[model samples]
Each structure stands twice: as structure tokens, then as C-alpha cells.
Target: AQASFSQVFMGVAFTCGAEEEVIPFFDRGLPVEYELTRSIRVVAKTNRKKIGVLNTEAKLFGGFDFQSMRSTPPWPVVDELKKQYDVEQVSASEPIEEEYDALLIALPSSLPQKEMDHLQDYMEAGNPTLLLVDPLTIINVGLSPSEKAGANMNPFMRNQGPPPKEKGDIHALMTALGVSWNKAQIIWDQYNPHPDFAHLQPEIVFVGANNPEAFNQEHTASAGLQELVLLFPGSLRKAADSDYDFQPLVKTTPASGSLNYSQLVQRSFFGVQLVQPRFGHRPNPAAYTMAAHIKGESFPDTTNGADSDTTQTPTRVNAMVIADLDFISQQFFQIRQQAVGNLNFDNVTFFLNCMDVLVGDESFITLRKKRVRHRTLETIEEKKREFREEQLKEEQEAEAEASQALAEAQKRLSEKVAEVRQRTDLDDRTKEIMARNLQEAEQRKLDALKNKIEAKKEARIQRSKEEMEAKIRSIQSNIKVYSVFLPPLPVLGFGIFIFVRRYKREKEGAAAARRLRA
Candidate 1:
């Protein structure tokens, strides 16, 4: 039995890449022979893509560290990236090496001109990069000393303002990519919100990929992501003459608009911070881009030896710019952590996916993509909303008119009864009975009128509902008929036509042959 099983296994193994096979039998059995084929060698994967982190010492605006804390492990995101790729901390002063697949600049407080030139050179060479920056720099000051030094002198005060241009190349790079970032304006959304941070209003906006107006579903970076929470995120607008193909990855809802954070902040007597509303004109509400993917030619290649004059070669450049950096901060991730469940937000996944795409490591994207359970329904049309409002108004007016008519009928009936009671010819009992009968008739009339009004209202409502249902059914029926029967009709008609033509041709041919023979 063992020999038989081995023979069957060998037959199957021969079709596969399996190599040498050895079959052993009991010592008492005769020598057993098994076919020996060439052994297959397995090669281990060792070449991991290199990811260079640029400007690790740059102070984050919100007093958050880009690297890990002293005692705690490095930011989970950093550690996660290290697992898949070779991560290295590189300084801005040094030239980015060709070995590095991509560069990451996370919440840098400043970028010197030398470093900017290096980055420009790197990107212009057809390399990809990720820029995670905040438009406004956050400063916490509890005393006068804190204001002078620009450092966190006091831990009690919270002051935020626009960062100086010298701090980083956010504006320059954004302009190059055809995106304009306004540090003074903060994006807010009243519709989609986070539960814990509801009091912060628009300062903390929750955007999901399923929102068609807010997220670009066509882009792979934002495709399957569920939700991302932006903390004091700045607004991103497209430049009119941008040469790159700008695709918005994340955006605020239609309820969002730019609010001046400087004017909105006010300190209360108890030292509590308050966001005061603007008294006069308000900014128009619209969707604003939070993150975008820009792809285009880096620059005109002018150094191809003698061919440089005749033909200009431009390398394709790809870069992703996010208006806010705090979304992926360790502090924000900790705050968003759930006590009992998988993480609620997809910030980490989004960051990783962006990095992967920038570095041309799209194979990692499939592992991070998740199906979100919470989905927002599609919005209704403005015309439909207006029609509903009109229907309600007409119903209210009808009710008021019915009530007035009933009151007038009752008043007239009462007057008639009183006049009949004043008649002198009628006896006392007769007069009493007549008045009672008149009162009963008035009550019946009132009840009938109420019934009639109710019936009419109900009928109208039912008719409207039926009409709507019928319209829906008609649309569904048309779709079904077209899908099931419309496609085959042409084919069926063609087949019948071919058969008829063939039959006619055969009959004619037979008649012609018989006549010729005759």
C-alpha cells in the first residue's frame, strides 16, 4: 500500500517543480528504486526598498515629536514602515542618495535653502517624495517669556498662528504642484464629525473616502480608506495655471469653508478658550482639498550631451502633499484608539499607502486596504427637497381652511335653532324637542364635515404615494426589460432573416435548375 501511494504521489509531483524523491522500504524487503531528479533551489528575498526620512530634528508645530518618545517605542507607523522597507534617518544638509527609493518630510519646522535645492534636484530626477506639512504653526505659551522665545516656555497657553515662509518650502513646492495652501484659513465641516471632538467643531473634520464630493475614488491612495480625522487642517486650492495633473485624494464636505482662526479665538475670564463667530459676512461654503496627488514632468531635461539641444527629455515626477500633518501624529493616534475594537480611523493606513505609492511599492497597498462598515447614503436632489416643502405647506393651508368652514357651519346651525325656539305657536315640549333635534342635526353635520376633510386629505396623500411608487416601478421595469430582452432581439431577428433568405435562395436555385434541364 505504501509503495502504491508513493507511486501516485510521484505522478502528481512530476507535474509540479518537485525534485528528487526517495522511497524507503522495510529492511526485509528487496532494494527499492525511486527516480532522482534535479533538486530545486529556493531563493530568499533580500532586496528591501530604502526609505529616507528627511529632517528628523525639525520641531513639530504642536509640540509633538516626529520620532518616538524616550521610553516608548518609536511611533507605530515608523516601526510598521521599517518592517516592510529599509528605513534610514537622513539629514536635509546631505544630498539624497540614489539608493533611496523615496523621501519623507514630516512636519518640519524649517527647511534651509540648501536642503530645498537638494530635494528639487532629487525630485527632478524622476524620483517620488511625500510632504506632510501644516500650514499654521502651533505655539503654547503660558507666560510672557514663552512669547519672546517662541518655544514652549509655559505649558498652559495654546496659541496658533501662521508659520513664517522661511520655516519650510511648503508654499514653493505647493505652488509648483499647482496647489495653494492658505495657513490663515482652517477648513471645517458640520456634517461629518468625530464623536469625542464634537466641541471643536470644524477644527476637527472627519472625512471618508466614500464621500464622493470630498474624496477621489479613482485614486488608489484614497480608494478603500474609511475615514481620516484632520486636526486644524488648512485649506488647499488648485492653482489656475498648474502644469501638473492634480487629483484630490481627500477633501472637506460641502458644508466646509475657510474660517479665520486668528479672529475666532478669544480667552474667557476663567482662562478657557472660546471660538467666537464672525459677526458680519461669512465665507462661501464648499469642498476643500486636504490632500492631493500631483504628477507631471519635473523639469525640462537640458543635459543629454549633444542630443540635449535637439530633444528635451522630461522625467515624470510624482508627489503627494497633505495640508495637515497632525492627523498621523502619535498623539492623535493615541487619542483615536478604541478601548475595545479595531482602530476606528484609517490614518496610518493612508499614510503607509501614500508612502508605498510614492516609492512605487504598490504591492503593499492590497494588505492595508479594508472594507469600512459605516457608509454614508447618497444625497437627494434640491428639487425633491423643495417639492416636499411645498407639499407640507399646502397640507397645512388645507387644514386651516377646513377648520374655518366647520366653525361657520356650526354658527349658522346654532342661529337657526334659536330662531325656531322663539316661535310662539309651538307648545313647550314640542319646542324643547325641536331644539334638541336641531342640536343633534348640527352635531351630525359637523361630524360629517370632519370625516369628509379627513377622507380628502388621506386620499390625496395615498394618491401621491401611489404615483411615486408607480414611477419607481416603471423605471425599474424599463431597466429590467432592457437588460434581459433588448440585447437578444436584434440577434433573433437577424437569425430569422438569414433563414428566410437561405430558403428563398434554395427554392429559386432548384426552380432555375429544373427549368434549364427542361
Candidate 2:
């Protein structure tokens, strides 16, 4: 019965960047997914199911309540979704194990490690988990300078040693999940740059593979993701064996190669530290840094759980790592117009689609249709606004044109009256009579011209009314949603029966009239 009401309500969790991007992408049309949590409860009938949502971070900003934080919340996407789905706000720490059919995790680098560990457990249980690991920062722990600066080109003489233990720990964590991250380089690409950054000299070479086979075609994660940016030096390679079914989803172009960590660090974060040769001997043309989805088993848990029934499940895990983490910063989000190449949507969408894989099919279909309808309606509205403005301008110009034509007609008529008054070929009486008749005729002509102008104005008004009606009808047609409540099948059949009976009665009455006439 709730589905009979034409609306979807969405409760958005403004807790993470990934969620933020995901919500708007689906609320409006683009190749992205919409998420529902326990925080928002959408009303659904037999076919429609309410999506429960949880606002994990809603409590921190305000009290442990969502309704109180409504005044200043910035998650408009959530609000838009609420119009179609039910929204609920919940704590971030709570595990959304079975409240909803699907899940979307948009945890940024700031999410707690313990939460991520819980998420890992969830994924191991065959639930879809989309992981986004930024190379620069993950959960606020970035690669230290000492960890990145190897012996190859430590021009600044910055202390260099074997990479830090934490780096290895991060790698081990990723490898256990079939994904790894190398913090040694920045993904420098020749094709893509923030418009402001494009003019500067790019040193660290990054490449996104031009070939289609570079990515896994079968996986849901890489769907519609055409390109990726990676750093040149110290990039993560595919550690899994070739026999492993997991495939590389993104790679660098052939002309690109990795740079040493020192050079990239010096150029990117630090001002120019070394002033030497502008160019150097290039290494391999390209190196494989980031790869997605290597099929493997989960790492054995060493916890001292006394329960004998506890068992780990073998499931396919999706992983993504880039050499640079700064790509997700606010700076990059601002480069929509200035950038020559692709932007972050490629990476954002890849992770989003993967999460959608974890969600229910009906939810995904509803979101897709809603997005298409909403965006199309918005575009049509914009067009209508523009058309109305143009029509108003045209009407004003036509009125001005009519006024100018009347002024010219009056001027010519006045000149003819003056010419008749000055003529000497006629007698006084005849000239006077002719002049009076000409004056009356000109006045009548003026009134006739004014009537014509008024007629044109009325015609334009009627045309405008008809046009507006047509536009309204078109919009109504677009809004006409199908529903069983709209004239039931039995009701329609009964109406047809009554119409046929009335037609037969009318025909019998016509035959009686013909008989009386005969």
C-alpha cells in the first residue's frame, strides 16, 4: 500500500566521502549506485521493499539523534533519496549485518581501524565489500619520508633505510586480501591533470593502460571504469601468481615508467631540493602498480577464540590500490572543468559499482529508474524555462514592431492631409469637403489598423495558451506512472459492458423511429 504513494524516502549517512559521492551519482543520472542504510526506512509494498539506513556519524556532530541534526546537515543526496526510500540514522560503530539486503561502505581514510577489521569479517562471509585505499593517506597513516626514500636517488641525503615495518604491515594486510599498496611514488600521468596543475612540469610518470584486456571484464568492480591514474615509482605490483584468476583492472600506458621515490617526494610535497639535470635515463616504459581482484583465500585468523564452531569462509575479495592518495583530496574534486583528461569519477564509480554488487537487485533497479526519470525531468524543466524567456522576448519585440508600424502609418496620413490643404487646383468648397472626407477616412483607417494589431495580440495570447497546455500535457504524460489502482481490470470491463448495452438501446430506438415514419 505504501508503494501506491508515489514517493521514495532516503536517509543519507554523511559520514564518509565514498558515500557522499555514491549518493549524488545515483540521485541524479550517471553510472553509479545508490545506498540504503538502517537509518532511513523506505515504505515498500509487495514488490517494493523499504531500504533501512544508518547514519554512522550523525551522533558525533549532534546528540545521539538524527532528527536534531537535520537543520545543518549537508547530505542533500540522502534527502533526495528519502523521497523514494525510507531513511534511518544509526551509529557508525553498529554492524549492519542483516538490517538490509545490501550494503554500501564509503569509509574514507579517517574510519577507525577496528571498524575496518569488522568490515573485513563481513566481506569474508561472502558479503560484497568495496575497498578504496588511497596511496597518500589511509585512516590518517601515510607513508613517512623515511619509508619512501630508498638508496636509488636520495639527493637531499634524507635518511634512508629499509622501508618501515608499518609499510610492510600495510602490505601484508592488503596481500592477505589480494590487494597491496606501495607508497613510494605519485601517479603522474601525461594525459590527466587538474587544470591548474597541468601547466606545471610533471616529473613522476604514471600511466593507465590503453588496452581493454588490462582490466578484468568479468568482474563487477571494473565495469564502466575506463582509466586509472598511478604514480611512477614504488608502485604496488600483482603479487599473486599468474594461475590466480584475479585480473588487472587498470594499468599505465607504454610511454610511462616509475620514478624513484626521492624525486617524486621532492617535487610534490617539498620544493625543489635538487637543481641538476632536467632529464634522466628512463627505466622500463611501464610498470604494473595497481591491480584489482586477485582470487585467493582469506588470511588465517590467529585470534584465541575458544568457540570450536567458528570457521572462516573462502570468498572472492575485491581490492584496489593506487600509488598516490592525494588524488582523493578536495583539491582534485575541484578540477571538473580545468582537467584535460579523466577525473576521479572513474575510480569512484569502480568502487561504487562493486558495492552495488553487494546490494539487492531490486534496490539497484529502483535507483536506476529513479535517476533516469529525475534527471530527464530536470533537463526538460531547464529547457522549458529557456523557451519561456525566449517567447517573452519575442512578444515584446512584436509589440514594439506594431507600435512602430502604427507611428509610420500615422505620419504618412498626416502628410497627405497637409498636401490636400495646400493644393490650389480645387475650389474652396471642394477642397474643404475633400479635406474633411480624407480626414475621416484616415481616422477610420487608423482605427482599423489598431483593430488588426489587437487581433494579432489576441492570436498570440491564444497561441501561448495552447502551447502551455500542450507542454502541461507532455509533462503529465511523462509523470503518468503505472499502477493497479488506476482503473482496475474488472472496473474497466464493467464500463465496456455498460457502453455496449447503451449502444444497443440507441440502435433499437432508431429502428422504432424508422418504423413510425414508414
* lDDT by candidate, in order shown: 0.60, 0.45
lDDT of 1 by residue, 1-518 (tens): 35543433322122223332222221211111211111111112346688877753333222242122223335545654665677877776767775688878765434656676677667666678887756433322111110112232222332444432233454675575567776556666644433345355556778865456666778888887777877767776777666677888897755455666555454443332335554211224457888988788644434655565575666565778887766776754454433123446777768888998888868656655644466432322232223333444454455566667778888888898898899999998999999999889888988898789767766765565456446545655766778899899999999999999999999999999999999
lDDT of 2 by residue, 173-246 (tens): 45555554554443433333233443433333323223444455665555434444332323555556322245
- Off-target runs (Cα >4 Å) in candidate 1 are 1-44, 56-73, 137-169, 193-197, 264-283, 298-316, 335-343, 375-518
For candidate 2, what is the TM-score? Answer: 0.39
Compute the lDDT for candidate 2. Answer: 0.45
List the pairs of residues colliding in candidate 1: 110-167
Query: For model 1, what is the error of residue 126's alpha carbon versus the real structure, in angstroms, after optimal superposition?
Result: 2.4
